[model samples]
Target: MPSSLTPPPVQASFGDTDVYLFREGTHAQLYRRLGAQLSPGGEGASFGVWAPNATEVAVIGDWNHWSDLADPMRARADGSGIWQAHCPSARHGQAYKYRIRTRNGDVLEKADPFAFLAEEPPATASRIWTLEYDWQDAHWMGTRGAANALDAPMSTYEVHAGSWRRKDGQFMNYRELAHALADYVAGLGFTHVELMPVTEHPFYGSWGYQTTGYFAPTARYGTPQDFMYFVDHLHQRGIGVLLDWVPSHFPTDAHGLAHFDGTQLYEHADPRQGFHPEWNSAIFNYGRHEVRSFLISSALFWLDHYHLDGLRVDAVASMLYLDYARKHGEWIPNVHGGRENLEAIDFLQELNRACYRDHPDTFTVAEESTAWPKVSRPIEMGGLGFGLKWNMGWMHDTLAYMREETVHRRWHHDRITFSMVYAFHENFVLPLSHDEVVYGKGSLINKMPGDSWQQFANLRLMLAYMWAHPGKKLLFMGGEFAQRREWTHEGELEWWMTDQPEHRGMQLLVGELNKQLRGEAALHQLDFDEAGFEWVDANDRDNSVLAFLRKSRDGQAVLVVCNLTPVPRQNHCLGVPLSGTWREILNSDAKPFGGSGWGNLGEVRTAPLAANGHRHALYLTLPPLSTLYLKRDADV
Candidate 1:
């Protein structure tokens, strides 16, 4: 249930059920009864926090004049390690922190780990807020259960809200983004918009990855209600919303989770297992029952309170590996002397199971970059139970191949075809995410090896190939319009790039790619099955050309040919199953896409000549540095 409709009782007290569930790691609605809830009497608020190590705890805020001696909390009689206090003066909208006296005699002030709101960054006080909103997205929520299925057409527009677009050099608020961002993404023809983390964090540079408030939507945009409006508006516009969820590690800020109550309650006490050296953060103690409940409650809060369509979990690879980013002596092995983090694996399994059990319409995706098997498989089959997994191997290999000079591309042709080796192993999302466009890596367009004209041409070919490939699609903001500069969290995307014809043409190509991807059943219906794709001529390395066929479940098919070289092939012959004319559906070399205007014009006829083991062949003109999509005549 949403917390907005489930406030605590007037004289709330912890019960045995709460204690049992918390200890058993089954407390999905802990956010509702815990945290600061308004008193049923409407006098003030009831504050509760789990701080077993604290010898004493108090609520300090503006209401108490930040006094450590005022509003002391009492330990629960159920022996649940929870402290609660009913303050008649600490009402809604007041900022507060828990002042705890540790066993070592040190006093510490910490923000509420389950706070529903927090003061914006540079200030670390948790605010008392009642979660309430008039949602208007029932139509979308009712029909979203099947929208993320394996066979559905899902082309996602990966966005960083604070930087997607700005007005007068300032971040756009959620209300403004609700309308503007929704309209823009809809026009681009993407079915979903995946926002970079919006959870409350202290630093803008972390891009919301280093979260401080798990339950609070970042005030960097607007209030929690405003964020509800953002999701609602996007849903109303027919765009599903996905949040970037970071459960791997959290920042070690002083007022944050680290060293709370002068003890490592949230993280493991061992540095080898608890501390993340690369991010300078703390890894959650997934083996702990209360900790698992806390994290699980956070995951459910977004879906229940804000009506989000899905969660794209970040750094899943880090969570799964015990030796991630560590030297030989710097890490500790699991109980079985293995490198896998067994506790995290169990937690993820439970998380996925809970998501499907509680909110069947919502999906979970893993940003896992490893060979961990069956990531998108079901939990019942010993798999991670994610709806989709990012195909990082494909992204890395394809980009590396594209960066090579065209004259040398033939030698590295395997990079283009190798992904198919494991294409069906897991349901994949071919992601060109924000990570690819930042941190000293050049923009997608800049990665192409060529002059201005050829750069745009290569980008067009890459996108067309992505759309026609065997997977769902995802592209980060600004990539569609060919932004010349690498992405930075500090500023918005270069919207002015669309003024140039080359940039405009690149954007147009992306839009058309999305349109075709959604309209053609052969492109998406059988994405995960071997029956959908058949290679026509994958061994044409010398000429830098490859051809394949994509088939829908209904027997509809589309033929795709790629010319990777700068020089055009006048009569490229490839086998076809149908004996009829194949009409050109999309060509990267079309003039409208800023190509060299060299193509088959519109259609090509098949010959009875045998080629590539097929009885029928098509001798067609293949354009340079382009990808062509051709649909066979239905009359055949």
Candidate 2:
């Protein structure tokens, strides 16, 4: 090949505004400019990369027989430290990498950080590809704002695509998973589906958490268009898609961002500030302006290109505190001599701001397991500016309370009741996520303390309690059907378990709970406000019974009562806001849900006698180890 085939560096196709904003750390659309982009009519491609410390850079790919001297890139004279070149022979679907000569004369070949598609893992080369998909969810895109609103009933089904289902011991393609997942989620009445990270990673065992290609979806499933179809299929079925995004840390793989250009260009030089001991990963240098732009741009790219409804940021607590998972003196303090990660905090605030500003119809959630105040509050109000936050405290306390024997549950009643004191502190999502059912923690069903029958009942009761509580809901895969084994990425869920009566009953109960949550305004409309919840009897320790009212803004209400022990309580008097017939909307102890056929006979009337501080009260049967939802008959 003649040397003239490699043209001299020209001005980037993207404008100078992108460069200015990138340097200022405010660029949210760098994907359009910095990555390998196909030229018009697919004649060739334009390549751009940022490697300020590189002494020389060249594009080596299949088009040029992987020759390092074939297409040498030229550095821009604008002092932006960007190298660019045009290769007319570089067509789509060609594997490529940048060979960089470090300042100290060492050479390194790195995958494109902003690649839209990567060669399937076990092969670390980036592929030249185009993102072109004809989306068919115009109706979903037009009105998703209301469906994703705070008051809307949001129940998320967390899934791992590779393990969600496999065909003949092989991973299902994105298109196949899309149809199967959409059918399953819509049938369960869940409003949204939260996918674990799909970003490219060399290790399948990481489950996509140790992400490398920020802008590319893993090719293990399919192409970028395939992933787009997955989202489009879900949206068309009225199920929103939320991606679990990891901006906290990345793996220290040799082919990843650990050391680019023979230096820690993307990470801090100091081990104390750059390393994550717990995850065995390298933390990004959030203090760098270019790094901020890169992270934020990755976040926006997903929502913009994939038509995703929201994002659930992962490991936020690790980003918020410098001392996270580190022993004394093992971590470095911020400039203020505090343990807080000030640079990371600023990056998070900016990320949320940019996400909301660009996609106001969408939302962002934080999996923050700390007492960080105002995590879901507005940025202007001295907050982190997230739309929702995972309720880790609630998950831990509730599980702890449930694991105790019925006879001992009264002593630990506060564990179940304490969450209400801080429930309204932030917009919360009561997540029984994958983290709860792994590493010998046991499946959610096995966590209960009881015989086979009692275990099933306890599982149903716990799920009912989560639905009736004040917050949005999220349940990991297999938990809905009471899978007895712990979750693992290596295998698909036990789908055959649903054939059993007890297991199928649990599935039916979850579907019913979701239906009730969406059908009744009181169950979800005021999930984040104190006024939506009222304690009818929170201190019934001796009986191990608790009752509360979930009210809507329009005065509609649902009365929820839970009996912790396996001892049935007949004629359990509970207060009612209305003086009329109260209908038993749902009963976990009903025969259909693998429980003894014990409950109030459909409905009960409230008498004039006052109880639990109400003008009228109802004496109803509360089943053993069950939760009941009652709503007053509007006709009465």
Candidate 3:
């Protein structure tokens, strides 16, 4: 293929204005002018890169038989470190790399930092490409602002595209996966699918976290246009797409951004500041104006070109704290002797601000696993300005309590109820993410402590409790059903397990939970407000029972009750604010969910008996290892 989609040879260069804006770190649309663009005269492609430390830079590819000096590039007049060259011989399908002669007299070939497509791993060559997909999701785009509002109902299904499904032992391409994934997620009633990092990476085992090409989607799945089709198809099915973005660190591959231009240009000079000891990656130099411009531009590229709905930032905790995952004498403190990475703080704030500015309806979530204050608050109020933060504390506490034997669960009652102490500290998403089910941690279902039957019951109860808890919800794929094995990036999920009744029951429970969450305002309308939640009976540790009420801004309310132990509680009295009939809106112990069917027949009449600080009370049967959702009769 030709290096571009144009007609003939023309001058390919970045103007002085482009250099100035890039130097000032204000060029959010740098992709427009940088990288390989079709020539205006319609002949070939314009290749550009930033390599100030290089004595000479040339475009090398199959078109020139990989000759280093076949296509020499010119440096910009401005001192912005940009180089450009027009390759009339380079076509759309041609592979290319920048051959740079470093000041040290070493010639190195590096992949284009702005390449739209790249050859699959084991071959590190940038491809001259163009994206031209006709999107048919205008309705989804126009209405997404309201659909993705903070107060809206959001049940995200976090998925790793490569492992979700496969055919003939091979990964499904983006177009094929789109049709199947959209139908499956939509049928399960998930409002959105949060994909694990889909950025291009050399090592598939990293699960796309160690990105090499920030602007390009992984070719393992499909072409860039095909990934766009994946997003568009989901949009048409009324499902939003949230991509996992890793701006915190990048892999140390030779052709990657590690030592671009034969210097510490993208990362810091010192290992303590730039190197990630745990992951063996390089932390980006967030303070550098040009590097900041690069990262911000990458984020904008996805939203602008791909029409993505949101970005879920990864490893935010590591980015925020300079001492994260480090021992004594292994890290440096800020000027104030604090652990905070001041530069990263500024970058994240600016990132969130720019994202919202460019796309008002889109959101950014922080995968920060710390007690960082105001992580989801507005930047104007001295906060990091993220739309949401993963509720790591809730996930940890709930999982710890659930893993305990049912007989001993009463002793750990506080673990289950302690999350409400600071539930509203920031906007939160109760996430049972991919991290929970990998690296020998066991699958979500396997984490439960009980016999086979009780394990399924416990899994259903945990999910019910998670949905009814005071936050938005996120569950990793295969968690909807009771998959018994931990997740592996190399293989597909155990989809065949769903044929079993117990597994199918868990899937049904999740589907119903999503439906109820969307239909009930009390479940989602005021999730971030303390006033929306009230304790009905949080002090029943002796019976291993807990009850609470979720309220909308309006008068509507739904009561949630849970029995963590296998011993059922009979004639359980829970106070109700309303005097009308309260029906069993959902019972995890119902027969359909493969439970013992120990629940109220249908509804319970609220009696005018003073209990648990309310004038009216309802007597009901609480099933073993189950959660129940009750709603008041609207007709009363």
Tens-digit per-residue lDDT, 1-636, candidate 3: 122222233364577777777887767877888888866554678888988888788888888998865688777656788888888778877889998878887778899888899998878888888888999999999999988998899999999988999988999999999999999999999999999999899998999999999989988887899999999999999999999999999998989887888899899888899999999999999988888889999998999999999999999999999998899999999999999999999999989989999999999999999999999999999999999999999999999999999989889999999999999999999999999999999999899998998999999999999999989999999999989989998789999999998999999999999999999999999999998999999888888899999999987999999999998888889899889899999999988888999998989999899999999999999999999999999897
Predicted structure 2, TM vs. truth: 0.98
Q: Which of 2 and 3 is the better model by lDDT?
A: 2
| Residues 374-400, model 2: lDDT tens digits | 999999999999999999999999999
**Residue 358 error, candidate 2, Å:** 0.5
Q: What lDDT score is found at residue 399 in candidate 2?
A: 97
- The all-Cα superposition gives candidate 3 an RMSD in Å to the true structure of 3.0
| Candidate 2 wrong stretches, greater than 4 Å | 1-7
RMSD of 1: 3.7
TM-score of each: 0.97, 0.98, 0.97
Residue 23 of candidate 3: its Cα lDDT? 82
What is the lDDT, from 0 to 100, of the residue 326 in candidate 1?
Answer: 94
